[model samples]
Target: METSTASPPANGRVHHPGLRTLVQTTRFHAEHRPDTAAVICEGRTLTYDALHRGSNRVAHALRAAGLGEGDRVAYLGKESEHYYEILFGCAKSGTVLVPVNWRLTAPEVSHILQDSGTRLLFLEDEFTQVVEGMPTAPPETVVRLSAFGTWRAEHADSEAEFEATSDTPVAQLYTSGTTGLPKGVVLAHRSFFAIRDALASEGLDWIDWRAGDIALIGIPGFHVGGLWWATQNFNAGTTVVAMRAFAARRAVDLIRDLGITTACVVPAMLRMMLTEPGVSAEDFTTLRKTVYGGSPIAEALLEESLAVLECEFAQIYGLTETGNTAVCLPPAAHVPGGPLMQAAGHPYPGVRSKVIDEQGRELPPGAVGEVCLHTPARMVEYWGLPDKTAETLVDGWIHTGDAGYVDEDGYVFIRDRIKDAVLVAGENVYPAEIENVLEAHPGVAEAVVVGAPDERWGEYVHAFVVPVSGHEPSPRDLHTFLVPRLAAFKLPARYEFIDRVPRNPSGKILRRELRDRFWNDSARKVN
Candidate 1:
């Protein structure tokens, strides 16, 4: 009957990455904590044993569909247990999982499918028409996840006989850039939990993943912060309750209904929840810890949230390329109106971070420069981009595009971003990508995009356009044109008709000249 599960690979090709794959963790929890809940959403709960069996079926079914080791499979959906099942399934069978941003336009989704050469795509049935409308051909095998139960039933619920180790490439999360193309950050399973596993081995329970802890995931599935934080609990056999989409009321309701003990959100998300009509301080009583990150937090927002939530509030700073949180501002250091709260906390265990000058020389403490990190959590490479991999992962240090400084106490303070990335409500919106879309219009001669300060959303995408001699483009006109090409968050909120965009001798748009006006009075250059 072949009921026995496949054993860990003996190839020695994996070369002892010093970490366990998701497959090993799932099986271990299923055997040791069979009845513990791993995930909960939309009135359904998947216990450890159930998650293992479901993922096993998915792995076997995918392999039967002609997908082999190292093949690429993609998922496009909102948050759900089904997503995790497919993710762990891919992990079990040595297939790479690419989760596309569901909010992306058809053209955006098409670009990923074509770029990755994906063979299989699993998605919600309602989005079938989206795949049909792709600018390029969709994957060869498309499975409607609405029929997942039947599809899984047709395959065996046992581990696929395969050779996969912790070092095997597992996920490819796309991060867009100034080059106007998304770069896939290929990560291994070992890097996924490198920091957490290190902390656990050292017997430190900072975030404290207890057996009965209910972790809340309110972020979108496409972003690493959303999936990465939630799965940390799942890997520890703790219960995780997640939302299909993040909304102010939904996050508040989940806390009330689930007695959620832990959660992570961006600053804007916290503001939205605080301003929600029915929300009261009592609503957040169950939250033992709330982690916020993505963009730097404003002081007033920090104070207000700490006062309202009445829970331990911590700040995490990291990038999709660094796996996750490399620096954390612990609860104790979140003192309002104090010097400690202003700086991002020290690096995580086994993580070394420093700021460097433009010449790549390490800067002394309290110097504003680019932030660089040395951590096991660094991505293996940018998928299929050798030059970028070399440029970024130099000397075992990943160069973060953020301009920041570490204080005498080792607290990192972000001053500005070296990358042309505008963060709108925690979503990374590359300026060049938006500028390209703007310049595509017949009425626009040239365009530049820059971050504008905002009370909410941290920053908004503001575009300055030099109209073509004969044609004039209004804010409404430009907004309407861009709505079809870019995500709503990435679209310019305000448009300024300009004579010409400032440029240097080399013809590079001077984004700093445009950005400086908005942040004139602020000490921090970033919004």
Candidate 2:
């Protein structure tokens, strides 16, 4: 059951406990289940007692390196069981944990390191070459944690010295820019725990896997899904099964062979798993629940998954600033014709969501507007971008910039991005609506819409499309498919064939880059 010592205050503001606040709970599970396995990595395992002691040692080592409250340390590596030990250790030591993106190049990584003013970086040997070349890399400290023994030997019992208070920032997730350069979003300790409590309040109990239950993590640990899985599984005393990288075949084999009871995946990953060779409905019997998000799952895919996996699926939605998830669509909501899949679900227990216009005026149900979220889980602010922060966050509501509509039942239906709206012949057209129409074409595999410069019109709608394998549809055929369905001005003025559209890990199209090529050399950038 959801438990909180304090209640929500007035005007949707509520004070909650901190992230390091759960250390005692960790300690409790450790003492009671000392020898029980806590983590499973490459070929080694660590028990709850071992993880507790190992992290305590990490705290001591970090302190010896001059790390303490208010200092930020970044980690650039793949997801492993040891990652959490380092994260929890930072949580205990009152230091902020900054997880860097491993997919990025050295220069990309350098930008974050320099921006965060990261005092120390803990990286695996795989990234040694990348780190050695970065001139902007911090001189604070560099440590290599290879094996559990190395950490255990240098460890000191300093758990007491490491305590994170409610207001202390726990971690920082650098935003994935759909606009400009990424900004670091700092989350507080209280913010983390409160959201966890909110998840529980909705009868969404943490998976009750015992110490022997293998919890497979396929996504990069730097992402929220991977991080949440590690901590929550440890919090529930489950054994963590780590994957350095994701391979669909390997992920399926692990679940079938290792008895993995819990897992998390994004919509794209789920789609890949369903298409993997030799994959069968029986192969997923060991998976008790699968948590998916990052983008909406199509009804067709959801149905196929329900039939094949035969397990509970939870669709959660939230940003880095909202502490992973402020809303979740539970398994029961997955039934056919149910309202859940059509929405992002209601706000998490302590979270309040509303649809509003640019002026912050609340819109009535069924009206499309920006999705605004107000929660204690909001980050302190965008790191070093006070002006941008003020523009995005107003009156405590983080303007999602996502155009969505809420039904009378409080269900949210995301439409598209406000910035993605294209202007053609003095009319505004949402690319998502156009893409949706295009995706419905049987011969269309993928489609992305962007505004291109036009002499007559300020901007014209252009579509970059991918045709289905073994099927060829001419431009005239494709245009015919849309002409009958959409307004003339909203139709694509031009179309180009492509193998695929460029997208971020979250599956959001990089429209700006698509438009950059032509606009860069144009006399009038907007023409």
| Candidate that scores best on lDDT | 1
Compose the digit string of candidate 1's lDDT tens values, residues 211-306.
467889866667778768866776666788878877889889999888998898876688679878879999988998898887655565678799
Residue-by-residue lDDT tens digits, candidate 2, 107-129:
77888888888898888888888
Whole-model lDDT, model 1: 0.78
True-structure lDDT of candidate 2: 0.74
What's model 2's TM-score? Answer: 0.88
C-alpha local distance difference test of each model: 0.78, 0.74
Clashes of 1: 0
Q: Which ten residues in a row have the lowest lDDT in candidate 1?
A: 10-19
TM-score of 1: 0.78
TM-score for each prediction? 0.78, 0.88
